[model samples]
Target: MTPSTENRPQMSVEDFEELERHASETVRLEFINGRVQAKPVTDGNHDQIIAWLQRLCMQHRPELWLYGDRGMKVERYRRGRARPDGVLAPFGFPAGHGDWSEAAGVLMAVEVTSHDSDTHQRDRVEKPDAHAAAGIPVYLLIDRDDRSVVVFNQPEDGRYRHEEKLPFGAPVKLPEPVSITLDTEPLKEFAD
Candidate 1:
């Protein structure tokens, strides 16, 4: 699920950390710059897609670990902390957040698009900048809104130098990071 920053106030990283320490288990929050955006609940389709990608990545690398919406503190991006929908890290990286992990060991981050406008913008626009700035090698976006998948690779100067967008039925080729191709044929669209 993507986060919505509607009435959220900007909070410093220190303040955000303090808030997270005492945050309720019932409400999930992601701090970007100073905004506290509530993460939406994911549906079955969202869960299925995440699992599918995890399987694909794990199958190829075998040694890499995959995370689901773990709070990550991206040091290179500096000003923001993101809980990407999927985080692929080397074997020995913490499975969950005790403190924000530096984006150094992260091979790739995956974000599955949701229905809200704010969510869409966060996944499609804001996060790419943040992820690239964090020096993450690859960013994979499975966009429900467009019924397509896009891989952003070759991070440089705060952005990915290469982007390949493919419709659901086509294969998405990931470079470096994982260095494998993913089949999107199993993904199903939401019913109207």
Candidate 2:
């Protein structure tokens, strides 16, 4: 589900930032692949999924924290902005950050598939490429649509060189830098 950026309106980072700032609280905005995208307000099931992952991270890796809806600078040359569902990093990593933070020290960028028209292109394709290009070590996609988890790592040359997908009830290991094994059985309960 790769998105074609050819017809996307070219927007400067500054312009995107200004627009994002003025957007209503309910509307989250992102700049990916040279285009501005409005991120949909998550549903209850989506919130539950994020909460579940946050609890898991807290239990397995006390030193780390899963920051929800944390805006980040991503993609090649940090030209993109994304508000990932969760950004896993060391505790207090975002203490002094402004609206958007650099990708440094981020262990993983996570997205739980939203029930939306653009979920496929936004979560599955553009996000992985943006995070990989930013040199973020891992990109975790919890795909509600397919009831599976996709782990992407070993980023190189603006892409992830390794990818693995597992169904909702299986155990999934989020590789190095974020070495946590998830018992995904609980995820099935949240499947709408």
Candidate 3:
């Protein structure tokens, strides 16, 4: 995805966390720049996709660690945050914090895009750059709007030069840093 050189929102640690203080159980917030916004609750279609992924990752437990929508705080250089719908990491990293702002051991991040246009854009663009900057090798986007999945790999200088999109029902190959072999067909039950 070619991003315009246009400025994207970048937030400080303090501003990034305003959501936790105000967000209700029904609304989930993710940080953007110095502001936080509510993310969409998945529709029936989207829920099926998430369930499919959850099952796939769990099947290979012990070898690979699977993480679901949770805050990740990467505080090393720039303090920021992200909550991926699914994260695949090698099992050896220290457990506890899934927040990218705290530690940078995340190997892969997968965000299942909802109908919200803004959230979709952030997941595809802003967060990928942050993940790359943190040295995350792979980023996957399960686009609900388009019924497709995109895998970005071959990170160079904090950006992915290689990207591939697999349409719904097609088999998707899980790359390095993740141990499972899967495609979207297994997850169709969650699709709307």
Candidate 4:
């Protein structure tokens, strides 16, 4: 079961950043809703899904880059720090930025659902809220659990004003700013 905010470890943003700096490479931590949570290590299928999207983005939007596991400062007033599975941004957007870069120019934040108890809360709920709160243009969720693709966009009042869910093998248009159509048929092979 996912822990409640009061039950999770609480820390200031500064403290969380310090802890993240000292964390080993294998451990990835996120500060969300004023609590510290460890992100699950991704599986091979997860990595493959990211790779597939990465290649697709590069081929279609050469001017943009899909960065894997890039740290981003999100949420209202940028209080939250998250490392999304894939961050789509203008080429070289993260240059000279610190560990957690502001989400200013981020076109999309992608998350592939991991097989874990907290997947529903973390990926489907909190992440979309955080990204939308940061005014990110799009939030793409490749949900393995449901074998579907969820596209979230049009941020307003700390939430996405629009959401579209399509089953695997369906065609998905990532919408503008992102403006890339995805042939999700390949995603079927990566489903767990």
Candidates' RMSD to native: 5.3, 3.4, 4.7, 3.4
lDDT of 4 by residue, 1-192 (tens): 877778554888999999999998888999988878899999999999999999999999999999999999988999999999999999999999979899989999999999989889999999999999999999999999999999999999899999999999999999999999999999999999
What value does the lDDT take at residue 5 in candidate 1?
70
| Candidate 2 structure quality by residue, lDDT tens digits, 1-192 | 866779564789999999999999999999998899989999999999999999999999999999999999999999999999999999999988989999999999999998899999999999999999999999999999989999999999999999999999999999999999999999998878
lDDT of each: 0.79, 0.95, 0.67, 0.94
Error of 3 at 17 (Å): 1.9
Q: For each candidate, what TM-score against the reference?
A: 0.87, 0.95, 0.78, 0.95
Model 1: per-residue Cα lDDT over 66-163, one tens digit each: 78887777534476788889999887787464767778788998898877757766888878878898899999988887788889988898888889
Ranking by TM-score: 2, 4, 1, 3
lDDT leader: 2
Better of 1 and 2 by TM-score: 2
Give candidate 1's TM-score: 0.87
Q: In terms of lDDT, which candidate is stronger, 1 or 3? A: 1
Error of 1 at 128 (Å): 0.5
Instruction: Please list the residue runs of candidate 3 whose C-alpha ends up more than 4 Å from where it truly belongs after superposition.
Output: 1-11, 74-76, 90-103
Candidate 4 wrongly placed segments (more than 4 Å): 1-9
